[model samples]
Target chain A: AQSVTQPDIHITVSEGASLELRCNYSYGATPYLFWYVQSPGQGLQLLLKYFSGDTLVQGIKGFEAEFKRSQSSFNLRKPSVHWSDAAEYFCAVGPLRAGNMLTFGGGTRLMVKP
Target chain B: DTAVSQTPKYLVTQMGNDKSIKCEQNLGHDTMYWYKQDSKKFLKIMFSYNNKELIINETVPNRFSPKSPDKAHLNLHINSLELGDSAVYFCASSQSNEQFFGPGTRLTVL
Candidate 1:
């Protein structure tokens, strides 16, 4: 079975500092990868997705993720972080077109430090 | 307008009581889904419906049942809810791949 792993359970970064969230996936074939952010008491918002083509994919909220096939990793990156960026981040991997059912990783809670 | 909306954003009930979460999507998408987010913030897919047909049913408990009245509505009914069912439930809709999610309904079972 396919699965997603987010190693960092919690990450604290200073405001304006660069941020990176690591995501690894175990799948038999090329996978569909996604990053979602959930604010307190709110639904999750899609940050970025990696399907095919360019290894680097840009997403909303000034975020980007790189898909490394060999590494089996799709890590989210932002050049500068803001206080509002603090939230629970989830990484998911699943079928690209079928039911689009996704298996999500244990979320990484991001805390912004002033 | 809300693309995906869920009724009763906050539900509090007893352990043995039953509850239902209603979801509607105005996006006119054929696929809808139900997801559970545990206290620790871990999320898992519970059920999915496409055009009023059951498409994906995860290994969720039988007490948790899902019904799709039409392409736009998917409702989850939990019978004899347990304390462990206290978590945030999210409804989502998809057209092709990208899914739009609702604000989420937080259920509290005391």
Candidate 2:
């Protein structure tokens, strides 16, 4: 079955430190991958997406992700962690065909330390 | 201006009651979808509509029905709500690959 996995249920990083959140996907064909973040009491906002070309995709809030086909991974990375960066991050694989549906991972909660 | 919006940001109702959540997208997208987030924060797709036509329907229960009046509007109606039905419902629309999501509706069953 097609699925997305976020191994870390929770992560902590000190302010000004670099951070990386892992994501893995299981799919039969070339998949469309996406990263989204949700703050407390807020809706999810699209951080970035990987469709076709350019394995390394840049996103808002200084976030980026690289799509590694061999490992079936599309991990999100940030050079510096900020207090505001602490939130729930989700990785998703979608639409396999059409209809714009998405299958999301369980999500990883980020807790930033001072 | 909000690209995607949902009404009744919070809904609290007793079990066995029927309720509906409305979603609208101003992005001029042709595809719309409904997703459910459980207490565990696991998000799952429940339905998808393209051009107001049902395209994908997951293993959702019959009590949960989605109606799309147009390409930009989709509404979810639930009948005989149960405790397990309590969750956060999110509506999203897509023009191509990237999807825009609404603020989400938090439903609580008593």
Candidate 3:
């Protein structure tokens, strides 16, 4: 079974500050990885995805994540986060099969301080 | 345009009651899924349908039943809802790797 672990339950950062959200997965084969963001009272939105490609992938809202195969990690980073960036972020892992079930992390709630 | 949409964004009912949530996707995807998100923000897949055929059915309770009238629609019906059923249910569709999600239906059982 593929599982995603987001070690950070909650993170606080000042507006315009850089941010990084840690995500680690437990899967035997090279699984597909994804980052999703859910705003307050909204559904989850795909931030980015990593299949078999470059180690680093860019996503919406100036977000990027690097897939470290050796470490079994895919960490999301943003150079500067706006206040609107405050939301719950989830890390998900799935098999290469399309429309398959995805195992999502516990989700990290980000808080932005003015 | 709403690629995916769920009806009755909020559902509030008493225990032992039955309720249903409807989902529709305009993306013309052949696969649709149902997911449950607990208050703790933990998401888990409940059911998946491909071309109106049941594919993945997780260890969800039998009280929860999913119906796929077509490839673009998947509806979830819960019987004898309990307090534990008070969670947000999300509907998603995917033609390939990436899935598009509906706004979600927040169910509250009193």
Candidate 4:
């Protein structure tokens, strides 16, 4: 079965500091990877997605993710974190079949410290 | 306007109750999906309908049924709901590539 793994359960970073969230997926083919963020009492919003072509993909809210096939990882990175960036982040791998449903990782909670 | 919307944002009911949650997408997309988010925030796909055809049906229970009236609406109906059915339900739509999600409906069983 295909699965997505978010190694970090929770991460705390000071405001304006650089941040990185690690994600690894287990799948046979080159998978469609995505990063989604959910604020408290809000829906999941797409951060970025990687399908093909460039390994580095940019997304909304100044977030980006790099799809590394060799490492089987798609890690999200932001140069500077803001207080508003505190939320739960999820890494998902889209099934390649026709339906193409997403297999999400156990989310990672981000804590922004002032 | 909300791209994708699900009615009854919060539902509290007893076990064995029958209930339905409605979903509508105004994004002009032909595909819609239902996903369940557990207490641990782990999301799993339940059902998907594209252009009024049932497409993806995960290992969901038979008690749960999805009805898509047209291309833009897909509703979820649960019969004799169990305790395990308590979770946040999300409605989503997709066009050529990207998928759009709605504010989830949180269901609690007492």
lDDT of 2 by residue, B1-110 (tens): 89999999999999999999999999999999999999999999999999999988998999999999889899999999999999999999998878899999999999
Native-vs-model 4 lDDT? Answer: 0.93
| Residue runs of model 4 more than 4 Å from their true location after superposition | none
Candidate 2 TM-score over all chains jointly: 0.97
Question: RMSD to native for every prediction?
Answer: 0.9, 1.0, 0.6, 1.1
For TM-score, candidate 1 versus 4, the one ahead is: 1
Give the winner by DockQ.
3
Looking at model 1 chain B, report the run of 10 residues with the lowest lDDT sum. Answer: B92-101
Which residue ranges in model 2 land beyond 4 Å of their true spot? Answer: none
The full ranking of all candidates by DockQ, starting with the best, is 3, 1, 2, 4
- Count clashing residue pairs per candidate: 0, 0, 0, 0
Candidate topping TM-score = 3
Clashes of 1: 0
Candidate 3 vs 4: which has more DockQ: 3
Off by over 4 Å in 1: none
lDDT of 4 by residue, A3-113 (tens): 999999999999999999999999989898999999998899999998899999999989999999999999999999999999999999986554468889999999999
The segments of candidate 3 whose C-alpha lies over 4 angstroms from its true place after superposition are none
Candidate 4: docking tier: medium
Range of the 10 consecutive residues with the lowest summed lDDT in candidate 1 chain A = A94-103
